[model samples]
Structures are given as C-alpha cells and as structure tokens.
Target: MRTDSPRLSRPATFVRAFAIACALFFLFPRHAHSQIHPTVSFEVASIRPVAGGESGGEGGTRSQIETTADGLTMRNIDLSEMIEWAYKLQHYQLSGPNSLAGSRYDLRAKSGDHVAESTLRLMLQDLLATRFKLQLHREQKKTSVYELVIAKGGPRLPKDKSATIPPSYPKETFPRVVDGGFVFQNVSLGDFAQQLTEIRTIDLPVIDRTGIPGVYDITLKSAASALLDPSGPSILTLIQEQLGLKLVSAQDLIEVVVVDRFEPPSAN
Candidate 1:
C-alpha cells in the first residue's frame, strides 16, 4: 500500500515562494547611486578700486558732428551656448544613504530617459565654489521704529509708517544671523575699520542693491560705511575661475534634479 502524506506536496509551496520572490525583485530593482562631494569654498583676497577716465567734453556746444553719414554698430559675445551647457551640468545628487564610498548610479529622466553620470552634482558645486570664491554669511535683527501717535494732544502719525526710518539698530536687537557676505558682523568696529584698509575698491555699475542694501542707502550705524562696486571681481567671477562654470542663458530651462548613483557622506 502506497502512503499518501502532506509532505509529498511541500515542494510545490517552496517553488511558489521562490517564484514570487523573483517576480518582486524584477518589479522593483534598487537603483545603486553615489553622493556628490562638496568642495572647499574660496574667498577674494584683495580688491583694487578702478577709476573711470573722464570722457573729453567741455561746454554743451563743444561736441559737434556731421550726421550726413548714417551707420549702425552692434557688439556681441556668443557665451549663450556655453552658459546652456553649464546649467545642464548643475544636477543635484538626489539619492539616499548607500554603504559604499562610491555609489553606483543609473541617471535617468522622469520618463526614464537617461541623463548624464551621477557624479555631475559634486563636480558642479566644487566647480562653482573654487571658481567663484563664493563667501556666505548669515545675520538677523529685530527692527524697532517709533510710531508717531496722537497721544492726548501729542503729534499726528505719518502717512507712510513703513517708510519711516528707524534710529540706531541695536546689536542686541539684531541678533539673528541671516545669510549674507558682511565681514564685520562678528568683529568689532575698530577691527572692521582696520580690515577695510586691506581691501581694494573697483566701482562697477549697479544692477540691483538687494544683497547689499546698506551700500546703496545709509543705515543706523555710522560704522556700516563699507561700499561695494558690482562691476569688478565678485562671486560670479569666483565660480567661473574655480569651477569653470557659468550661468545658464536666459532662455535655458532649469530643473531640480536627483540621481541614483550618489549618496550623502553620513551614509559612510
């Protein structure tokens, strides 16, 4: 008599489990990626002030020219293509923690399209930092301005309260350190004054005074007299020199990117 037991059917269960595991592995394969390393930031050592030569013109009628001949002149520098490539090269390493020092990567677009190698992000940051000599600082402050109020029979309030300029900006009140490039925030006024003697000035055309508002307008502190000219050496030049990178053209599309190959250092 042949014995029919439950053990005879155990092989089928093992086969089913193995097949399921294989199916899952192919369905969601891990993307092995690496982390882009950040390089050392650089700073400008000295700046020399440049003076503009006067254009020869005396009296209003001193300049006279014949307009019988008509002409048009155009000047152009073709840096647009270079800028586009630089922008494309700034891919941020979007990856998670990995075990290895160098992570494996298969960079791709949202549609699963292949992009450049995963190491691009670290290369770009290092390029910008070294070339631009970018310097960053942070500071914060609590603004206090007296509002003129008609107290009993005192005075009338100004039409524009926001426009009213405040008196002295106390250091204690302005304790928050926001990101900026002020070299004297932590130093004493005396030390800052001495530091200024070492710097050079190069007067450049002003595009925007958003970053250095104090340079454009007077602040509460008399010691905040440091001036800057935008036309000369700046963060923009530093990035170009250290990293061989430039801004993307006005027409180029910018996107936040992530890659599979790179991982952060903390993972190590």
Candidate 2:
C-alpha cells in the first residue's frame, strides 16, 4: 500500500495553504472583518433665524381735566404729542455663567450634500471655546429643549423632499415700560422737548400733572443697528425703538392701614 500511494510534498501543502488564505482575503477583507463603515448622524437642533424688537404701534389712555375758568371742557389728547423728545440708556455685558456657555452639535450627511453637520459644529465649537471663551457643559441643561429630526426618517433626503422651518426674531417687540401709550408722528426731538417744557413751565390751562405727574410714552419703534448699544440714545426714544415700550396709566388703588388703637387727645 505504501509503495502504491502517492504522497503530497511540503511545497504543495504550502501552496494550497496560500491559496486558501487568498480566497479568504477576497471574500472578507480586513475592513469588513473589523466592521468599518461610514455612518450618518444628526445635530441635536438647528439654529433659528433672529427676530423681535419694538414696533411703534397704537393705543393710548384718557384723562379728564376740568378748566377752572370754563364750566366744562372735553378734549382727546395724544400722550405722545406732549413730549418733545426722549432719550434712553441700557447696559449689556457678557459676564454671567450661562452667557459664556458651550454647546454641542452632532454631524449629519445630507443626501446630496458633501459637507457634514458634525464637522461644521465641531469647528464652530472650537472657535467659540478658544476665541469667545465659551464654556462646554453636558448635563442636559446646556442643551436646547428641541430635537433635530430628519424629514423622512432616513440619512438622505428623497428626490423632492421639503422641510418646514420656523420663523425667528432676534429682538422682539417688547414694551419697555408697562403702560398704555402711543407714538406721535412728524415731530422733531428738540421741538417736542420745547413743547413739553412750555406746558410744564407756563402752566397755561393744562391738565393737572401733579401727584402722579402724567408719565409720557415714547418709542423708537424700529430695528436698531449693531452699533446702537443700550445707553447712548434718549431713554424715551430708545424705549420705543428698542422695546416698543409705551407709557400706560398707572392703576389707581388705595391702601388700607391697620392701627392697633387710636389714642384720644392726650392731657391738654
């Protein structure tokens, strides 16, 4: 049997082993074996557009004035008309802890887009940390409440998919002073001031602006430039323009006093 059988050589066995190894390499390469893959991710949220600020809008209050000389007098007066001009001052500084907080952003791949969201976010985060001294945090509080979800529940968008976006206002129309008031058009600052002064100084048959002197309402009622910080402008005008804040009549209320006892007239 030994003389009849043909035996396999070491070189042949070596060659066979090499061929098997090559076949395995072709079927499952190093990359596949290690589970390497290109994955898509998403950001937690998106940046919304800026909006908000003042709108020099409408509405006012009414006051009754009884003329000493005449029996009765009735007139509808615009409060803003009483003022000549107004000035405002404000203070803004990035000093608080949250003011310099850091944010995290995840990266995502668009169907047709090449750039990744994560890449952009990382770059922005770095810039904020190094240049702006932004702080990074991760206890849920630092993150935005909203979530960034995909449109079609996939990494890529469909052929003609659309996304619904929300509106944003950087500065919102807020009432600087909580009062009912309106804006007077076509009036110069100096002229208005002079008129106000005249009404106060002359005291010529004007409404009694005593005790609670009539507070005037004035507003800028428009968007402000970046250069326009809080304090330089007149408080009156600045309030209108910056906050849409108007002057409203203060609520009339009487206070009650609790006295233990009223001692009658002491010994005369």
Candidate 3:
C-alpha cells in the first residue's frame, strides 16, 4: 500500500521528536521571576513641612534611603524631591505650581513587607499619587542632547582588575570633584552616566552609549555648570581631550513631565 514514502523507525521517530522539543525550548525560554515591577505602597506614612524659612533647607535630593523590615525614614526633603526620587526624574522636568519648588517636608513610613530602594521608589510614586493628589502625563518632546561616544583617541579608562563588584570603600563611595576634574572610583559606566545627567551643563539627561562594563575609575576635567567661555572648549570637548569620551549634538525624544494638578501637602 506504501507508494513513495518510507515509514520512520521507532528510534528515528523518537530522535526527531526530541530535536523539535529542544528547539522549541531554546526559542522561547521562560523566566522564573517577572521582569515588570509591581505597584508598591506603604502601610502607614507621615509627611510634615519643615520649619524656619531662613534657618536651612536641604539643597539637593537625599541620595540615601533607610529601609527596614517594617519601617522607612527619609528626611530633609520636599514633596518635589520625593516626586523626583520616585520617578527617577530630573527637577527641571517637573511642571506644576511654583509652590512645589518652595516647599520642603520630612517623610516617615512603614510598609507591609520589606522593600528595596527600587521598590520603595515605586511605593513613593504611589504615595505621591494618593496623598499629594498628583496628576501627570508623559509626552515626548524634542530636546537638544549631548550623546556620549568614544572619542578619536578611544576610552582612556583603566580596565578594572577587581571582580565585577568593586571592593568596599572605607565610607559611602561617591564621585569626587577635585581640582579641575571629577574622579569616580569603582563605579559602573551606567552610574557614571547617571552622574553626568545631574550636571546642569547638560541640558538634557545623559544617555550612556559606551558599552564598557564593570567598575572603573573615570576622571574628566570640566565645570559642572554651563561653560561660559565662548572660546574655550566645552565640557563636551573636555571629555574628549581628557577622558577620551566625546559628546555629539543630537535630537532626543525626552519624557516631558506635564503636571495636571498638585496640591500642598497637609501635615500628617
């Protein structure tokens, strides 16, 4: 009854089936953990305005967050700072009432479960949404940006001999401004890029293009503020000459923070 076809032997049939199964498994692998972050909220929280207008105010955002099994303490900050920390957004992006820039508050909260800084930031966003009655939307706006790229000389960074994780420093490690240059010891390229974004000279946020990985020391000679000298080389230029990195002009679609509504925070 068989015409032009030959039936596969049982061993051949099993091998073919096994090969197909392996291919499918490799093609679509499943992750044990979810990649998307969850919406987090604190169990109980308090917010209060700081006293003494002329006395003092924390100039910048708190770089640290203390989180315990059931409690969190973040101090010397305003609602605006909280919003910035929560969204990982720059202060300039915020658009709302002028009062937001003037107010400062201290926040203490307890969460149902232990949370990491990343999760806490998400929770803070929820807090802003619920407590502050914050409403906002993101719109892509064309903005001038400085794109980081390898210069003509190539990157001069010393390759990190340490393991992937940099050795623990004596104190909380931070990039230091020394003399006419900035020095970052034991820092990842991504973290360095984040630091560059903080500089006011950079109109738009920095986007890391260098694929160099692992912890390394970086030193760049430039002022953090906008370069005033028309004749002098800009920070973008200094980066290339000193650090073997250059910034080229480019147009980027930035997430413009549009604030629809914001109300003053009442004492908690």
**What tens-digit string does per-residue lDDT give for candidate 3 at 163-233?**
75423221112357767567766566666766676665666666667887767777776553325565667
Best by TM-score: 3
lDDT of 2 at 100: 19
Question: How do the residues 184-263 of candidate 1 rate in per-residue lDDT, one tens digit apiece?
Answer: 33222222222232234312111111121121111112222323446545633432343232222122222322222322
Off by over 4 Å in 1: 1-8, 30-120, 124-268
* Worst window of 10 by summed lDDT in candidate 2: 82-91
Q: CA lDDT, every prediction?
A: 0.25, 0.26, 0.67
TM-scores of the models, in the order given: 0.18, 0.18, 0.62
> Which stretches of candidate 2 lie above 4 Å from their native place?
1-6, 36-268
Candidate 2 lDDT over 95-173, as tens digits, reads 2332111221111112223343333334333332333343422211121111112223232211211122112101111
Looking at model 3, residue 145 earns an lDDT score of 68
Model 2 reaches what TM-score against the true structure? 0.18
Clashes of 3: 0
